[model samples]
Target: MSKRVNRVAEQMKKELGDIIFQKVKDPRIGFVTVTDVEVTGDLQNATIFISVLGDDSDKEASLKGLNTAKGFIRAEIGKRIRLRVTPEIEFAFDESIAYGSRIESLLTQVNNESKE
Candidate 1:
């Protein structure tokens, strides 16, 4: 990706995150954090990685809701960012938080066992 595209993607990620938090009235989208955005070389597609607060079910529901509102979100992005082509938005659940929690839990368990 070109430097320009990367900069635009970063800006879009911030603006879109704020818009979703303030404008999107979906209860399913709980405490969503936009982790990263990857725009395709052609600028025709963007994959947005998001982390949602809650268990697996909540995260699943949030992803579903975001997917359902893709068009609206895309339109909002188009409105907010003056770009030749508003990239098609793809919502992806970022599981790094969960993975980190799992690792922490394992480490804690090991430490406790060692202390016994």
Candidate 2:
């Protein structure tokens, strides 16, 4: 990605996080965090990665809520940022946090076993 695209993705990540928290009032979107954003080379589309702090059902609910509100979020982005055409946004669940937690737990278990 070019410097410009990278900047846009970062900016989108920040703004989307704020927008989801401050602007979006859906209860389904609880404890959501914007983990990362990936933009296409042409800036025609963006994939927003998110982590939801809850169980499987909560994560799915948040994803569904974000998808349902995609158009509104895109319009908000268009208003906040100057772009010829706002990149189409899609919300996706980011599993990195969960994976990291699992790794940490496994390491702790191994350490405990070694001590025993």
Candidate 3:
């Protein structure tokens, strides 16, 4: 069961990236990357973690655009994936990359301080 879920998640991650990149044309959605996806064990819902390359407002707008297009995206997924039930899609901004960058900068600052 767990393995199946993982596979689904992986497939979603790939398909979502392609869908968003090629299909979604909303100007609100700037440069974006589908980083990861988490599907519920029941296969009823999927939260797609995304990284947007822009300011906070751009991110917010992209999320809003995605939510607005949720139904269409789901329909597309159903058509492409052959799933008996297409999982509800949810967009989540991934912060781990930004967080890691911040941590690295902080560590560099500390190292510089130590040197001085």
lDDT of 2 by residue, 1-105 (tens): 999999999999989988999999888888999999999999999999999999999999988888888989999999988989899998888899999999999
Backbone steric clashes in candidate 3, count:
0
Which residue pairs in candidate 1 have backbone atoms (N, alpha carbon, C) closer than 3 angstroms, thus clashing? none
lDDT of 1 by residue, 39-75 (tens): 9988899999999988789889999888888888999
TM-score of each: 0.90, 0.98, 0.96
The TM-score measured for candidate 3 stands at 0.96
Candidate with top TM-score is 2
Worst 10 residues of 2 by lDDT: 62-71
lDDT comparing candidate 1 with the true structure: 0.90
Better of 1 and 3 by TM-score: 3
Ranking by TM-score: 2, 3, 1
Residue 4 in model 1: lDDT: 86
